[model samples]
Target: MFDVVVVGAGPAGSMAAKTCAERGLKVLLIEKRQEIGTPVRCAEGISKKGLQRFVEIDRRWISAEVIGAKIYSPDGTEVTMAEEMAGNEVGFVLERKIFDRYLARLAAKAGAEVIVKTTFIGFERVGNALRVKLKRMGEDWEVETKLLIGADGVESRVGRIAGIIKTLKKSEIESCAQYLMSGLDIDENYTYFYLGNDLAPGGYAWIFPKGNGCANVGIGVLPSIAKANAKFYLDRFVEKLEIRGKIVELVSGAVPVYGEVATAVADNIMLAGDAAYHSDPITGGGIANALSAGYHAGIVASEAFEKKDFSANFLRRYDELWKADFGWKLRRNKRLQEFFLKLDDETLNSLARSIAGKNIREMSIEAIIAELIKKNPSIIELLKSFLSP
Candidate 1:
């Protein structure tokens, strides 16, 4: 019997397996794809601050180093913000194919066994253990595990089979589509975010530079408000930009906009990364949170295995750890997302104009809320909910 079986070989699964194996636990990492990290679906942009805390980002994994950001209003008014003002490197557009493989190597080095082209089917509880079923090459095999970690992405079936709520409300998910294009003339060192209802309702469009005049241009909108297909909207925006470029790659996906899962841990199962809905509600960023949750879940699962207790009470440690790290911030961000959805294009443009000369990243949450309340007293009630203990 394996000490732990992690489903999915993404950042979260690899991190979980590595942590467990490093602590002397036998771990099994499974990947459904024959090869890892193919058909990359992410925007590949990550804030430099969070990456530093999770792993020592290898130099090769970085596709482009960003120094600042440009925010464009509805009517094309642009405001630039520097990394120094943001107190970080601003962001990094990663080469996910290499990065995901590197993380799997870390798990292997830590004494975890990895199986590719294996698809997890279901799980059966036997006495005090769980028997995980997987299909390899059209053949079925079962492995007994003391603990199970769900690191599967957005449409996680592992969490669902484990009896965790994986359903996302229409308003709580962002439908996104992106295109990688070459011959695009853009600032190679700065990421751009376009905000407005007409551009992307309840969300924003982004241009994250890759390298050599290449970039991942994408748009995200709340599924509830998206009247047409996400790809349709993305195409319209790209056309409007008058980008003279050749499309190199295309990616379509959904990002969970919910905070931490209500129950991240069950009897002998735990959910990490997107499986746990750890993406930021406002920005729809999950890479950092995924790694964080995976790390915490790994440690807690190891402790639980040693104690031979996999009950909800024993697994509560993972919940506590994640909450301590991200709970408050996510809740606050969710409130901001709600507020953003209600704003019209004119209001967003006016707000952008107001904050044009100001350093937005340096502004405190309370200060921003106070200004919003001053401008629109109707938002005062919602702001109080986020500010109040």
Candidate 2:
């Protein structure tokens, strides 16, 4: 019997397993894919602030290091936020395949057993312990574990089968599509974001530099207002930009825009990463959050195993730990997303023009909201919900 069985060998699963293994706990990490990071679904951009907090990123894993970001309005009004003002690289567009494999290797080196092409079918609870069911090479297998960590992706079957509410509301899901292309004559370092309903309703389009005239261009839209597939919108944008390139890769996926789930822990089970909805509501970024959550979950799972306590009350520590780390920031971002979604093209353009020379990072949340409230007093009521003590 293993001390902990981590499902999915993504960033979260790998981190969790590594953490547990480092604490001398027996860990088994399972992945359904033949390889860990093939058919990469992410646009591969991550904030430098988030990445530095967990692990020191190796330069080889980075496709390009971005120094700044340019936000464009529908009418082409642009606001450039530079790294000099933010005191960081804004973010790095990474080669996820290399990054993910490196994470899994770290876990394996820490003594966790890594298995690929192994699909988790379901689980059977036997009193206090859980028996995980899996399939590999058309053969059925079972692993009995003291704890289970679900680090699965957005479409998390482990959470559902484990009896967690896995349903995401229409507005909470961001339908995304991305393309890796070469021979594009664009900035090889800075990232670009286009914000406007006409370009991407209830979401945005991005161009993350990948060096050597290559880039990952993508768009995300809320399913509630997406009249066409995300790919359709992305194709239209690329055509409009008159980009001449050969498509090196095509990726399509969904990201949860909701904050972390309230019930990420249960008896003998815990959820982390996208499976637990630990994604940024506005940016649709989860890698950093996933790693953080995984690390906490791993630590908690190990402690619970040592205590021989796998009850929900014991596992609840993971929830508290994650909230202490990111709950307030997520809540603030959610409020910001609500305010942003209500703005039309003209209002957005006007706002962009107003904030043109300002450094957004230097401003506090209250300061930014105050500016918006001055323009529309009705925003005061919305801000009250988030600001209320």
Candidate 3:
């Protein structure tokens, strides 16, 4: 029996387990894969500040420290945003395989029982505690716990059984494919994003530098509007690149842009990371949000145990807390994402063109937006709502 059975050993799970265990709870952290953090699904970019909130700045897990981002319009115009202005998707590219392992090790260090190659099947209600089901080494297993945490990825089975998501519409999913490529000529200081309907349809292509002529080059496409799959656009984009490169690694996955769920809590169960649709609606970035939500989950789970209340009404504090933390940002970004998606390629080009060839490198992100509004007064109508509190 355990105080918490956190399924999936990704960033969210590891942090959840670690947080609970630190509070003296018996946490069992399980990863279904033979190894944790394999088959990398992320583009591996995170903000320096967001990352530092959880872990010390470790050079070992950092692939490269980027200074900023370069956004390219469909017509090939470039607009740059400095590190402080680029938001959460810029700053550092990570060696995710190592980073994930390090996080799991931290959970272990915190006294969580970490196990790999162990799958979470489901759970059954038994009084106030839950009987967590599992499969180890291809055989069924079980562990009774007071709480269950679903930190699984986008297609979360645990979330499904717990009724966190009903139907994930195609419109809410970003089908993404990425390749770790080397032998490419790239400005190591800046990550690059290219936008165009022809290039990526509803999504965009990116090149996040990883030092020494290597980068995570990828594309994400909204499946509902994409004529072809994500990999199809990725391949075409790579071929058209000015510099040829060799693929060192490849990864593909679905990212949920469905924003936050109605509630991430139900009785003895709670959801985190992609399971709770915590990825940013515009950028599909979740590492920071995962770390934040996981930490809160741990705190809330600890409080639940202390109060001796496991009911949903009691656990609703987790929902309230996460919402207080980053809920408004997610909701605002979702609205921004919706607005951006409605824009045609020409409108996107014009927006980028408005800021191109400017001496605004030192400007704040808000200033850059103001420049856009200054140049394209029409945009004020489209973005005023999001810009205002």
Candidate 4:
């Protein structure tokens, strides 16, 4: 029997296992795939500040280190902003396969039992502990665990089985598609964001450079508002950028941005990462949050063992810690995303025009909001919180 069983071997699960094992818990980490990281779905860009909090920056996994971002309007007006303006976007685009495997290896080094090609079928409550069932290589087996952590991605069967959330709405998820293209002549230092209703209804397209004449080009769209699929928008973006390159890889997936799930923990179970809908609402980014939440969940899970209290009430502390760290920021970003979705193409163009030739590095969040308020008084009330010191 294991003290904690972490499902999925992504950033969240591996971090959780690592932390739990480091805390002297008997941890078991399992992955359904034969390998830890395969068929990458992420844009693989993570801020240096956020990633450094957990794992040390590994040069082998870093494809490129970016300095700033370029935001484009529907009419093709461009605005370049340094990380100082937004507190994000300055980071490294990762070789996700190597990065993911590295984290799993760290977990193994921490004394967590790592298993692959093992699928978590379901679980059953047995008095104070839980009986976890799994299928590996066409065989079924069971293991008992004091606590269970569901770090599975958006289509999380573990959360469903745990009775946390039953259904995810269409509006709550972003449809995404990406490609690794080669031989592209573009700025390899700055990430580019293209915004407009025509470009991606209720969403945006991005070009995250991977250096060596290649980049991960992708788009995310609100499925409810998108006339066509995410791939349609991504293809158009590639054409508009004049990226006459050979497609090297294709990746696609859905990301949950409905804010945190109402219930993240229940009776000996906790959810982290995409399973808990920890993705950023505005950017659709989850790796940083996943790592953060996973670390917190692992700490809390270890405490549950020390106290010998695995009930839902005891596990609720996990949810509280997660909320304290990232829940509030995500909630605020969700409101911002909703406001942006209401913007028309003309408004986007005008917004871009207003910020053109401005030095964002010298401006703070409050100052930027003031400038935007002057250009568009109607949005002042909605964006006033940005002025908060």
Measured against the true structure, the TM-scores of the candidates, in listed sequence, are: 0.94, 0.93, 0.95, 0.94
lDDT of 3 by residue, 1-389 (tens): 89999999999999999999999999999999988989899999887877989888789899998777788888898897774543333478999999999999999999999988898888899999999889998999989999999998787888899886766899998999999999988888888889898899878899999999999999999999999989999999998875488999999998898876789998998989988998988788899899988999999999999999998898889999888887777887777777788888888888887788774554234456677888988888879765465
* Candidate 3: clashing pairs of residues: none
lDDT score for residue 263 of model 2: 80
TM-score of 3: 0.95
CA lDDT for candidate 2: 0.85
Tens digit per residue, CA lDDT, model 1, 1-389: 99899999988899999999999999999999998888787998887877888789798989998877788889887766664543356678899999999999999999999999999999999988999999987799999998999998888888888778658898888999999999988878788888888788778899989999999999998878878878888898999988778899999989999865677888899999888888888778888888888899999988997898988789989989988898667777887777677778887787667656654452133455555465667657866765464
Give the 10-residue window scoring lowest on summed lDDT in candidate 4.
359-368
Runs of candidate 3 exceeding 4 Å displacement: 83-90, 359-370, 384-389
- Per-candidate RMSD vs. true structure? 2.4, 2.3, 2.5, 2.9
lDDT of 1: 0.84
The sequence of per-residue lDDT tens digits that candidate 4 reaches over residues 1-389 is 99999999999999999999999999999999998889798999887777999999889999998877777899988876665543354678999999999999999999999999999999998989999999987799799999999999888889988789766787888999999999988888788889999888888899999999899999999988899999998999889878788999999989887875666899999999999999998888889999999999999998998899999899889888989988877777777777788889998889889987664552122345566777778777667654242
Tell me model 3's lDDT, rounded to 2 decimals.
Answer: 0.87
Tens-place lDDT per residue, model 2, 1-389, is 99899999988999999999999999999999999988798988887887888778799898988777777888887766664643356678889999999999999999999999998899999879999999986799999998999998898888888777568999989999999999999976578889889889989998888999999999999989878889999999889777788899899999988865668887899999999888888878889888899999998988897888999899999989988887666767777787788889998888777666654442123455555566667657766775464
When 2 and 3 are scored with TM-score, the better candidate is 3
